[model samples]
Target chain A: MTDAVKISNRNFSVFYGAIQALRGITLDVLAHQILGIIGPAGSGKTALLRSMNRLNDLNPNCRVEGQILLDGEDIYQPEFDAVRLRKRVGMVFALPVPLPLSLFDNIVYGPRLSGIRARARLNELVERSLQAAFLWDEVKDRLQTSALRLSGGQQQRLCLARVLAMEPEVILLDEPCSGLDPISTSRIEEALMALKSKYTIVLVTNNTKQAARVADTTAFLLQGELVEVGPTDRIFTAPKDQRTNDYVSGRFG
Target chain B: MRIPPRNTQALAVTLLAGATGLTLAVLVFVIVFILGKGLPVISLGFLFDNPQEMGKAGGIFPTLVGTLILPLVAILIALPAGVGTAVYLSEYTGDNLATRIIRFGTDCLAGIPSIIFGLFGFIFFVTTLKMGWCILSGALTLAIMVLPTIIRTAEEAIRAVPAGYREVSCSLGATRWETVLKVVLPNALPGIVTGIMLSIGRCIGETAAVIFTAGASLRLPHSVFDSTRTMAVHFYILAREGISNENAYGTAAVLILSVLLVNSLSYWMMNRFIARRTK
Candidate 1:
């Protein structure tokens, strides 16, 4: 990867009312690289990913201290428009949440909201996004069908295509494959590997093997604190932290 | 293993079945009695002709027209207001003191006696506002009376929408209002329609409120401001005064049939909407 820093957090901490979710931690996400975050439940993995796009802001009592910068700009500044920031950074959730709409409409929903009204352009965007998410061949003939009718895996891929239609700079996936079978999981992993070339991807997963397979760099978080972060191969083979070593080797989460 | 006593369980089952059978029997009895008495008087001339000789000799066509108009006007006014209030309460506000008070106010509104609503309508819409015994006054009264039902049901429906849908919409950079209009409202439509249907039933069956606000007039209403008599009000007057018991039964039968028709239509529409959504 290039030397450019796509996103970086400096001493960032997240609190929900009186309860803190993330401790003061620093990390850098390099441009055009997949950064995998792996941790067990209550480890703040989802919290960290949500904070990147400010999705955590939806919670009324959620508080963020310190800085989270995207392209060297503080995202939590008073004047910063969260709507615009979210447009630049998109998100996918654990379960597939296709809107109650057709597959074509789902892909065009974001674009339509952004004022893209040309039918030809929307059709092209749908095709390109589906192709990128590797869902075109499966769903091309039934583009006008309801998205809810798709299988669990296809629905998840449709969600990826929906986000991709916006042409976001960074994509945040919060356990995107947690609800899928192994074959579906592998399909998504392959999509992630292909996606890293164009967008900076931040993947939070409970499955460590998934991180090892697709992540260029993997960060291990435990109990709201970063245990270690390094090149994926090194982190898996010989982690510097004992906790990371034990966790990666299936000793403990 | 010792077998449990079956006597009490069997008695309980028998009691439940008897209760259900009793309810059904009562419903059938009422329908059969009304249809038997009213069907003889229901003729083409009786249905279409205006009442004459103080509503004792002719049909209830004017009252039927008034009945239809009152509910239509009431629903047109109440639906948007009630649904808007529900959306505000469920989507925009938090569980704060103000929200609690708003909810309490809605519940209170729902429990107020229909007679009290009638008095309020007479004072406010008929006398104070000088609407003066018209369909509009009656409709406005009914609208306020049914607002609570609409608000409660619509709020429940809007709240029932999955939070995941909102999160996904927001992540796609849709604004709060956009998310509500595009995703939330469409999903909650069946519930909203159900509420409206219930309000329609209430408006149609209401007698005391319409009597006070909409004066009993045998003539058909040409405008909203003209005095009118709904079927319920007409039936009550005819039966109470011993003017025409046959016409009263006939009117009651028509009212029941119309209510049933409205209910079935609403349910059919709601089922279609839900089916399309799931598809």
Candidate 2:
């Protein structure tokens, strides 16, 4: 991965009404790297990830202070188009919510909204996206069938394929494999590894093992505060913070 | 052998079953009585022929036509307006004071008496708008009456759509309107159709509102501007005026049959649509 920063948050703080979810957090997310954020519940991992693409703006009471930059540009600027920003940075939620549509249609939904109307192009895009998510082989024969019929793991992968179909530069995943079985989780991890060459990935996971397995860089957040961030091996083997060492070693959350 | 104490639960169950049986018996008896009295008078000649001697001697063909037309026009006016309001209230707005007030207003509208709506329609459509005592005026009145039902039901349906769909759509960069149009509406369609079916039933049976806005003219309406009478109004006048209880019973039977037919057809269509969607 290049050392070029794709997204940077400087003194970023988030508040849901009066309750602050994320304290002042400053971090640089480099291009083409998997930045795994390991945190316990209520550590603001989701807030930080959502703030990158302005998804937190959906909450009326959510307030953001400080700058979140995407590709060296302020994403929270008055003139920044959220719709366009979202197109550049896509997200997959914890629960796999496949649009109540056909498998083919779900993949094409993003492109169709962006006005890609050509049949041949959409067909090519759907195939490529599903392949990237490692779902093509399983669903190729029944692309027209309802996406809801897929297994839980396949649904999660389908969601990943949906984001990939948008041709986004970055992907934000919020505990994407939290509900998946080990086999499904491994498949998703494998897909992410293959996907890192083309897309920057930010994964917020409660499972430290998942971070260890897939991430290049790891950041530990505790109680809305960033305790430490470093290379995965170093963070795992030689954490500087006592809390990180304690949490990673299963002493306490 | 165990001695059973006083079985209060069994007694209560028996009482409840008896009440239910009595209610069903009454309903069946009324239906049977109506059919027996009205069947002989319901010949093709009695059905299709025009009324003679002020609806005392002839068929209710014109009344049947008016009954069909008035409700059709009412549904046409109310469905779009009601569903649109429902979508806006449920989907576009937040749960602020304004939305709460609007919901309150809708509930108040639902509770208002049909007679009051008839009076308002008479003053507004019949006099102020000069629509006259015609089908259009009646339809407009009934539209207002049924609007609340449609709005409430449609709102519930729209709200029942899981919030996850909206989030997913937004994450994919779809605009709010696109998500609503492509996802929300399609998922809420069956419920909306159910609300409309209820509205149709209410429109068919409504007499007070139709009587005030649509004059009891015993003739087929040539246009919306023409005065007409519905089956319910015709039945009411026949029975009240003591002209022919026979024709009144016949009209009642026909109304019930028509309502059954409509309900069955709509349910069948809805089931087919849902089946195809899932398939």
Candidate 3:
């Protein structure tokens, strides 16, 4: 089998009630790589991330016209199940969002919904997923406690674990560590590194140093258009685009 | 911040004291008058015995039971259905025409006059269906009457839950149903329960609707099909019929006391549920 679990979008434009948000933008996501999308506020970074799982579909006024393919399968086909697609392409939000459930339920929730029900198996999956998210030790003794009771950092990790339990092929992180402390940020970076072996990681962040620290590939988005994308080292060290360099150097948004 | 001048502070304090004292005096006078007037006729026999010879009244047992039964039935039907509709509106339904219409309908339902509901119940459940004066008709009427309360309260509660919770569940690849069941409902439960309590209060106190639809049967209702008389209805009948002035006063007092007790109990239950969830 080919190594690529590729995602390609051709001339994709998005509109919200006649107000165009994303201009006709084309992009490709390579497999098994961390793709970092960097953008300022309202530059469409969040919108682009939301589009991958078709979460934008939840908004009645949102309209998207384009061809988006996942490994040669058209994701925008009328028959495509958004729910199933979301399961395959999981997302983590900027805020720490633990469900109003016990931590155990938080981790096992997706797996159970996907039809895994054996008690022993669920417990094991919960443990494994939490460990993968680097939160097992801090939360092991309090697995049955409400997930909301966890500290902010722990809640974010728990959210990551919850997503990991679904075993998605692609994981989307929308500023996952934006709300965390330095230690938690490092832990999240470590978890992302560990996760890259199993899932194609796509991240959106405002932190340039974080992108330099974890991303294998970096793409800068300015005013809803892709400004530049390349290997992270080249993008950070010697970029071909002045806008990309200016953004990294903090010249302007 | 610098303190106000002594005269200004004193004037403010006096004003506050005067207002509070006046309000307290009025409240106390009303309570004392009602109790003083009504207490004389309250007897064990009056509470425990069934109405004798068409409400010559040694008892209010049937009315008390009927009051409890109708409101309980209304709550039993309204709690889940109302909360479910609220969950759909708050968590599932996007801002669309249908959601807007449903919300508008609920709002309009909430404001409709209770007497109109009674007339409606009388026509639909009683005359059209030939159900007659029965607990079923009364309970159904009360259910519709209180539904708007339940839905509005439940909707507010569901809305109060932090959006982060839903987003987290969605991120976990959980379906919308799963998110609502596991995350949203549990968090909003206390609010929903509060709504039910409020609905129960309105249902129990409702005299006009139950009287028209349920009829004034002094017997204990064995089923929904049986006619019943709630405490409020009994109070109204006693006051209107004037079997004796003493009986009317006693029945009114009993009805008031029961309503107070039920409201307090509902408040206590709400606090307990909130504490349990937070703990």
**TM-score of candidate 3 relative to the true fold:** 0.90
Candidates, DockQ? 0.70, 0.66, 0.42
lDDT accuracy of residue A228 in candidate 1:
94
Candidate 3 deviant stretches above 4 angstroms: A1-3, B1-47, B91-102, B244-257, B260-279
Where does candidate 1 stray beyond 4 Å?
B1-9, B275-278
C-alpha-based local distance difference test score of model 2: 0.92
Task: Judging by DockQ, tell me the better candidate of 1 and 2.
Answer: 1
lDDT of candidate 1 vs native?
0.92
lDDT, candidate 3, at A113? 84
Q: On a 0 to 1 DockQ scale, where is model 2?
A: 0.66
Compared with the true structure, what per-residue lDDT tens digits does model 2 show for residues A1-253? 4889999999999999899999999999999999999988999999999999898877888999999999889999999998889899999999999987889989999999999999999999999999999999999999888899999999999999999999999999999999999999999999999999999999999899999999999999988889999999999999999999998888876
Instruction: Sort by DockQ, best first.
Output: 1, 2, 3
Native A-B interface contacts kept, per candidate: 0.69, 0.61, 0.47
Top candidate by TM-score: 1
Indicate the docking level reached by candidate 2. medium
- CAPRI class of candidate 3: acceptable
